[model samples]
Target: MKLRSKIYLYSSVLFAVLLVIMNLAIYYIFSTLSVDNQLDRADAEAAKIAADMRRAGSEVSAPELLRAYVPIEGMLRLYAGDGSGPAPVTSAAEGELSTLKPVFYNEKHSEIIRVDGRSYAFISIPVIWVDGSVMNVQMTQSLESTMDTLGVLRLVLAGTTVFALLPLLLSSRVLSGLIMRPIVQMTATMREIKQSGKFRRLTLDETSKDELVEMGQTFNEMIALLESNYVKQEKFVSDASHELRTPLTVIESYASLLKRRGLAHPELFTESVEAIHSEAIRMKELTEQLLLLAKHHEHWNLSMKVIDLEELVRDSAKVFRNAYGREVTVKVKGEVKGYSDEAKLRQLLFIFLDNARKYSDDDIYVSLEASGQERLITVVDRGIGIPRDELPKIFDRFYRVDESRGRKQGGAGLGLSLAAEIAAAIGARLSMDSVEGAGTSVSITIAAGSGE
Candidate 1:
């Protein structure tokens, strides 16, 4: 069965069982106690009659005394043992009363008896008869009134049980609905997303803090993440195509030109060859960066260890300067240490230094220092700095400061974005401060080695 139905069925059954047990207990206790009360009242009346007979001391006539003390609706009798008696004294001589027979017994006692489908309670007490002989006074009272009262009680209890079930069923249905509402909404939202090919979220009730609300919030978070990844994927494909078109067109055109006129013109052949080669190399670099950018953060495999920041920076800069033949100034403010992946940190440095080299002709300054508990590395360049407004977007993948210059310089604008990823992977902070015309400086702050 569906969850709503199951909840309703199970709860109803449980309530029914509990209600039955409770009502049965009430009925049983009431019946037992009421019967005992009837017996107690009968015994009290028998004792009172015995006392009156003793007080009479044979002065009062037996028949007159019996008539005066007989119950309003029951029989009072005197039995002298051996089947002999003064006779039964009863208020009513007709119907069930005429059938009752009093018996003489040795001790005072009481009992309940049923006669002709009617219940009766009687108590027998040994007493001196007014004539000076030992006799038994038996008081018998009908249980009709108590039985009628019990009948009425049963009716009330049955009606109450039936009435109570209405509320139980109603509350169970309402509670089931409350529990299933979120799941139903979530299912509907999923259907909409599938049909429309877009992300959708549940409308939450923020006033309630429960597991259902938590489930809705988690679903919304998952949708948000999915939408973000989808947008990134689309942007990557579009930008890749845009970047590849220029180089592909150049290569295709140069090959077509070579086929048509390269044999007749040597300089035309050299120019076409140079242009094709340059575009091909730029295309290759762009493709490589695109592959690197496509990797998710969790998939990045980092080999972490304690490495001297000063040494890594010096070695990286030495390689950078030798390859590009650029003037690089290095400064060390004592020894700097950090826990990081050395190769990725070196790549991060290269991205900043290369950007500086592209925009400036003067010396690029690299500094390493220990500041409090953190190691700080900064690279400064006298380059044309970015506009302050564009700083936030600089690290976004495929974002560029100078689009035309970037194409000519063979930079795909993915360097800073990759640098950001690497810095995050190694638990470091990367930031840049720049003036529009003066220069740009990038810094990385990392905790000192805690060898884990």
Candidate 2:
């Protein structure tokens, strides 16, 4: 069943049970009081009759005494010895009198007896005469009026219960709806989103600080993250396909040419073989970079170690100078230390220096500076600097400001992206300052290591 229905059902059942119990208690108390009031009236009349008999002594007249002292609304009887006595003061029958015989013999004091299908309260008292003879006085009051009063009271209570139930049911339904409204809306919104495959958020009530509101906020945030990741994955796939297509097309074209005429012509054969080999190497490098990017996208476990930032920079510059015969210079302020993965830091430096060398024939400057709690390492190149708008996208995979230059220099446009990932993994910040023509400087700031 729905939550609203269940709530209404349970609440109604509870209210009904409470109503029954309360009404039953009230009925029982009222009935006891009414019965006691009747018995008290009967007892009072019997006492007056006894007092009158004691005052009259042996000459007391049972008929006259009963007539004078008995209540007008009830019956009174006198039994001088074996119940062979004057007729009762009221219109009660002999059968009704016989029912009271047990009260007289058993000393029951008082009891309620049913006569002619109507209820009556009976009271008995024994009196002793001056001659030592005993007499019994019996009085009875009809319960018809009391029963009628209680009947009316029960009707009133039942009516009140019914009246109370109308509002109770309505209020229960309304309150349950109010409580479940948020959950219903959430379910509906989710169903619509599932059908349309769209990212939608719940309309929250900011004024309410309820748990439902918090849940809605969390759900919206989760969907937003999912949407962002979904868009990024789509873009990544498109870019990877585009980047892979170029080298594959080159390789295919050269292979086709070699298949057609390179075997017959030895000169064309040498050129085609070299072209094919070069394109295959480019394809292999691109695949490797793609794999590395994927690995970094997953959980990257960094083997953190304390490494000299100054020493790492000098080593990278030396390798660049020796390998490419390019002019590279290093400047260090002091023995700057950093806590990070040494191998990843070296790879990051290589990415920056390689980009610098690819675009510039001038000398590249590598420098490390120590400041307070951070070590700043910079690779500066006086190359064709990136445009202001393109600088923001330099770390994006397969994005290059100088695409033709990048492809020509065997750069797959993943170097800066990889460098950014490594820097992030090592708790460093990678930033760039570039002008259109002056120069570009890539900087990495890492936490400074202790002297220990």
Candidate 3:
């Protein structure tokens, strides 16, 4: 069955069963109390009749006394000690007792009995008779009054039980609607997303802190994350194609020239081959950078360990001096020990140094120090600094402030982007500041807790 129908059916059945059981319990208790009350009244009446008979011993005839003490629809019977004497002394009665013979008791006694398929309340006591002998008096009343009253009660209870279900079933429908409302809305939102080819989220009520609202919130977050990744993926592909097209066109042109003039024009053949090789190397570098940028930082398997920031800085500077013969000055302040992935940290430092080396001709300065709970490594260079407007876009892949200068510098504009990825992978913060005429300062901050 559909969820709504199943909800309605199960809820209604549960309420109905509970209501019937409650009514049955009420009926059972009430019937017991009613029958007991009837028996008590008959017992009390029997006591009063016996007292009167004893006080009037020999002063009145049995028939006359019985006539005055006759019950409404009950009986009063007197029997001698053994019940083998004269006939039973009984007043007018309503029900027959052909199947019952009750025993007499010394003190007052009361009981319920069944005779001729009808119920009765029987009370017996010993009393002094008109003959000055002890006699046994039996009083019995039919249970017709109790049965009639109980019959009325049964009808009322059954009616209440059945009628109570009307509101219960109605409330079940309302409850089902309340429960299924969010589910239906979510389905509709999904359908809209499918048809419109765009991600959609459920409208949420902030005040309601139920699971249904939490579900909608989770769905919205997931959709937002997916949309963000999708936009980034599309932009990455578009930029990659644009960047690759230029080098590919250069290589193709040079290849065509080599194919046409290589055997005849020796100098032209050498120039063409050189051009093709240069573009081919640039293409290879661009492809490698693109692959690095494509992988998210979270997927990189980092080998985290404690590294001496001071030593790492001096080592990087020494490598730069050997490779480019550019003098790099290194300074260490306070304790420079930090927990991080050493290889990724070194790569991040090298990207900033490369950028500084390209833009500046003066000596490059590197500082390693500890401030508060973080390890700060700053790289400063006296190069042709970046303009203030281009600082924000510096970390975007393939974004260059001056494309001509950037191409001549052998920079595909992805060094800082790769630096950013490395910094993220090692849980470090990368920031940069520069002026057009002045130099640029790049800093990497590794907080103490970042290692964990």
Q: Model-by-model lDDT, in order?
A: 0.86, 0.80, 0.82
Q: Candidate 3 regions off by >4 Å?
A: 21-71, 74-93, 103-146, 203-218, 268-274, 292-299, 384-417, 448-452
Give, for candidate 1, the lowest lDDT window spanning 10 residues. Answer: 93-102
RMSD for each model, in Å, please? 4.9, 6.5, 4.5
Best by lDDT: 1
With a 3 Å backbone cut-off (N, CA, C), the pairs that clash in candidate 3 are: 359-383, 359-384, 360-383
Task: Output the lDDT of residue 239, model 1.
Answer: 81
Question: For candidate 3, what is the total of clashing residue pairs?
Answer: 3
Minimum summed lDDT over a 10-residue window in model 2 is located at: 99-108
Which lDDT tens digits does candidate 3 get at residues 113-140? Answer: 7766677898888887766777777777
Q: For residues 1-452, what per-residue lDDT tens digits would candidate 1 score against the true structure?
A: 99989988898899988998999999999999999999999998899988887688468876777788888878887778766775677776324675665567989989888877878888899987666778888888888899999999999999999999999999989988988898889889999999999889889989989999999999999889999989988997888898899899999999999999999988898899999999999889888877777777577788888898888998888999899999888999877789888888888889999999998888999999887778889999998888899899899888888899887777777889888888888888998998989999999988888742
Q: Considering every candidate listed, which one attains the maximal TM-score?
A: 3
lDDT of each residue in 11-75, candidate 2, tens digit only: 88888889888988999999899978877876776667666766785676777766776655567
Against the true structure, candidate 3 has what lDDT?
Answer: 0.82
